[model samples]
Target chain A: MNRKEFIDQLKSSLSRLPQAEINEIIRDQEEYIQDAIQAGRSEENVIASLGDPKTIAASLNATTQIEKAVGATSLKQQAGHTFQAVFAMLALAPFNLIFVLGPFLGFAGLVFGGWVASSSIALSVVAVLIAFLFKFAFASAGIFSFLSMLLFLLGALGAATLALIAMYHISHFFLTSTIRYLRWNLKLAGITKN
Target chain B: MNSQFNKGVIEMCVLALVKQRDYYGYELVESISKRIEISEGTIYPILRRLTQEGYFETYLQESTEGPPRKYYRITTHGKKTAEDSVRDWKNFVTSVDSTIHSQEK
Candidate 1:
């Protein structure tokens, strides 16, 4: 559809959507589309490339499990959600941290520090038993020597990411349940669903 | 795919989708309708729930064809909720699978 037609159709299509949301989306998208066109693309091509705006808009409205980009809120809302997210994350904080970070660090720390602390004793025993053999093969340089540093960095990074992920999930859990929670809270607090 | 399941998941699915990208109402419903079965009218109520819960906030824009249209955007709480739900879902699925088909035996 042409741009005007497309916007009209998009509007028609959006009738089923939340009215305020459709308006914001269209206004924002229109700016983006215009920007894209000004950057030297044909309006027709951009529109065509964008596909039917209705279809695009439809997908835009489809609420998946997690939400998309979130905006900064007023102090009141910011505080409330921050409280929710922080509290929620805090609720699961211990287990989430342990699960994501515990094992990897324990294994690596043990292998490294344990090897260092015991190496002298281990080497002395080995020297008496198989000194020549020990020299022949780089025994201490097993799985970790060449790869530990690299793997440790990667593992630490992975663990950090997992921690973040865990925190997010925990927060989401709280938020989801809190929808109903808020319902009751609001009712008690004397606010309706308006 | 049925209305019952759709009803159950509508809030979740819509919230999740918007968590990934901003979407208008009809756009959300239509997009989700493709992957899951839900009546066209089903989304509005979920939108109402999310908005009332402050998981979503809305604004209206002028339209060329008729009256202004309202757009819903996810609140920070909404985004957090979606992400957490997604994580929980993955965890739940993983645990169930592991329990059902663990190799320790």
Candidate 2:
């Protein structure tokens, strides 16, 4: 393929990336091709030696997405970046299908479960309150009965809230550590650096 | 040799070359490709990554023949990384060489 064809293919492959990043990558490749042609190498020869544009795009996308995941500040942003990074990595190498997907899916399931459990615990406090109210409304609840129910409600809500907080931390830890693990996996796969 | 193994060494060569002197995209590719067979495209991604990691700084300089060229210069952090990597590579080669020779004997 000629320079334009190579760049066009690379651009399409990298469509998921931000436009600014896409433009920068294109610029670099364009310059390389231009320099090679000027130095007396034919466009076909230079492009051939450069290898597949899709492979080049995969490498660039993986590198960019991995960095984005590493520097992500919010949980939503982190998750999004992690997904893109992992997708790019898998596309970059066929072996990652076996090496990356299994552990990634397992850890993702754990994190998803943690979030679901935390939210359910937080929501269950409402159920406790409703149960206590039903007991008071239906029966002639005495003062001691009323006080005990109130205490029970408070204890349950406070414990649930504490558990929710702890789960938030645990899930957060898992997310960040999973990203670190992905980077280490890339290194172990010999795709990139430390 | 495995291309995966070359990937690490290519990164080191990029670091080592840029540490020695500033090089533009084509220059660096030609320099390394002269001694090692690699898909020339792989070097650009490595350069992009190292630049993002703050190990290399790039600038554009006008060329007499065509459009301005982007040049890469190594940072102090990059120099230290190059030093460590070269040292580690040497140690690894020494151990591997000895193991091979011993097996042969």
Candidate 3:
């Protein structure tokens, strides 16, 4: 391929990247081709030796996707970035599916379980409070005093709120650290530009 | 050999080379490719990343023969990183060498 063909293929492959990043990547290849020609190499020779444009674009995509995953603001956005990054990583190397996905799923399950437990803890208190009110309204009072029931509800609600807050922090920590861990793994896997 | 191993060493080599003197994209690629076989395209991503990480700074300088070229200069952070990478690489090589020799003996 000539310089234009090479750049065009790279640009198309990198369509997911922002225009500015795409431009920057194309410029590098342009300069490399220019320099090679200036140094007396034929365009075909330089392009051939540079390897596949799609492969180069894949490497660039994997690196930037991980950076985006790290810099993402919201949890939802973080999840999106993380998936894209991992997908890009997997595309670069199929062997990574076993090494990367297994640990990733295991940790993701733990985080999901923590969130589920916290929400259930918060919701179960509300359910109990509703049940107590229904029984009190229709039937004779039970062993516990009304004041004591109110106090118990307050205590349970408070504990559930605390659990929710703690899980928020724990899951947040898990996500950030997991992204960092993936970035390190990418470096070791040679998917990222170390 | 292992491509991953080459990449790790290439990062160290780029840091070390830029620490010694400023180099443009083509020049650095030429220097490294002289010693190690690699797809020439690979170096640009590594260069872009190292610059993004604040380890290298780039500037455009006009060339007499053609258009302006982008040159890379090592930063203070890059110098420190090069030193650490070199030290770590040396220690790793020494340990691996000793292991190999012991196994043979």
Candidate 4:
């Protein structure tokens, strides 16, 4: 391919990137081509040495997406960036639909299930304590009822506390592993520039 | 060399070269390709990433025969990273070399 054809192919492939970024990359390639020609190299040789535009575009897209993921300041932004990165990976191969998407969905489901289980446990504890208080308020005051109420409250509080602690750990593990997994996936897909 | 392994080493190589002196796109690619077989296009992405990571800075310089050229200079952070990477690479290579030599005995 000639320099113009090579640059055009690269530009089309990188259409997903922001305009500014796309321009910067194209300018860099243009400069490289100009310099190579100035150095007494043929345009054909320069293009040949540069290799395929599609592969170059793929690497560029991956770098841009990964940077977005890493630099995202908020959780919502991070999720968006991760989604973009995953889509970019999926674009590289169709089998990634099964290989990457299936495992990611499974992981998301596991995290969601763990969260729901912990939250329900905590919610049930609250419900039981509230019901016990209502019963105590209506019934005649008795040492036995008061003792039982005290025991029930203590048990409920302990269970709630344990559930909350478990939730914290589960969320922490989920957040860290999600980020690690995204980075690993990008690297495996040859999306990472280094 | 494996592309996976080359990706990391190439980052360091670019940083090391810039640590010596500023280089533009073609010069840098030519310098690196002299030693390592790589798709010349891949270096641009690496360069862009390193610059984004704050390891390198770019400025345009007027060329005698052309309009101008963008040059890349290593930042202080880039220098420190290069030093650390070089040290780690040395340690890793030495250990691997000794292990291989011993196994051959």
What global local distance difference test value does model 4 have?
Answer: 0.78
**Per-prediction RMSD in angstroms?**
20.4, 3.0, 3.6, 4.9
Poorly placed runs, candidate 4 (over 4 Å): A91-98, A109-176, A181-194, B2-5
After TM-score superposition, what is the CA distance of residue A112 in candidate 2 from its true location, in Å?
A: 1.0
**Per-residue lDDT of A1-194 in model 3, one digit per residue for the tens?**
77789888999989998999998777767777889999999989889878778867776887887777777787777777777777776766668556868878798898889889889988999999988889888877755697699789989999999988887777678778767876666555542321
**If ranked by TM-score, best first, what sequence of candidates would result?**
2, 3, 4, 1
Query: Per-residue lDDT tens digits of candidate 4, residues B79-102?
Result: 999999888989999999999999
* Backbone clashes in model 3, listed as residue pairs: none
Tell me, by lDDT, which candidate is best.
2
Candidate 1, residues A76-167, lDDT tens digits: the string is 34324433432222222334334524553354454445435444444444444354345436655555554654455455556555554554
What is the per-residue lDDT of model 2 for residues A60-179, given as tens digits with 9 covering 90 to 100?
A: 887787788888887778788888878877877777656668877888898788778867976887787888788788988798979887888888788878877787677667668867
Q: Tell me the DockQ of each model, to 2 decimals.
A: 0.03, 0.45, 0.39, 0.37
Q: Please state the CAPRI-style docking class of candidate 1.
A: incorrect
lDDT per residue, candidate 1, B1-105, as tens digits? 434333234566788888777666556755876676444434544665487568898877665644455677889999999888778778977998899887666
Least well predicted 10-residue stretch by lDDT in candidate 2 chain A: A185-194
Evaluate residue B83 in candidate 3 and report its C-alpha lDDT on the 0 to 100 scale: 96
TM-score, chain A only, candidate 1, equals 0.33
**Cα displacement (Å) at residue A163, model 3:** 2.8
Candidate 3: chain B TM-score against the reference chain B: 0.93
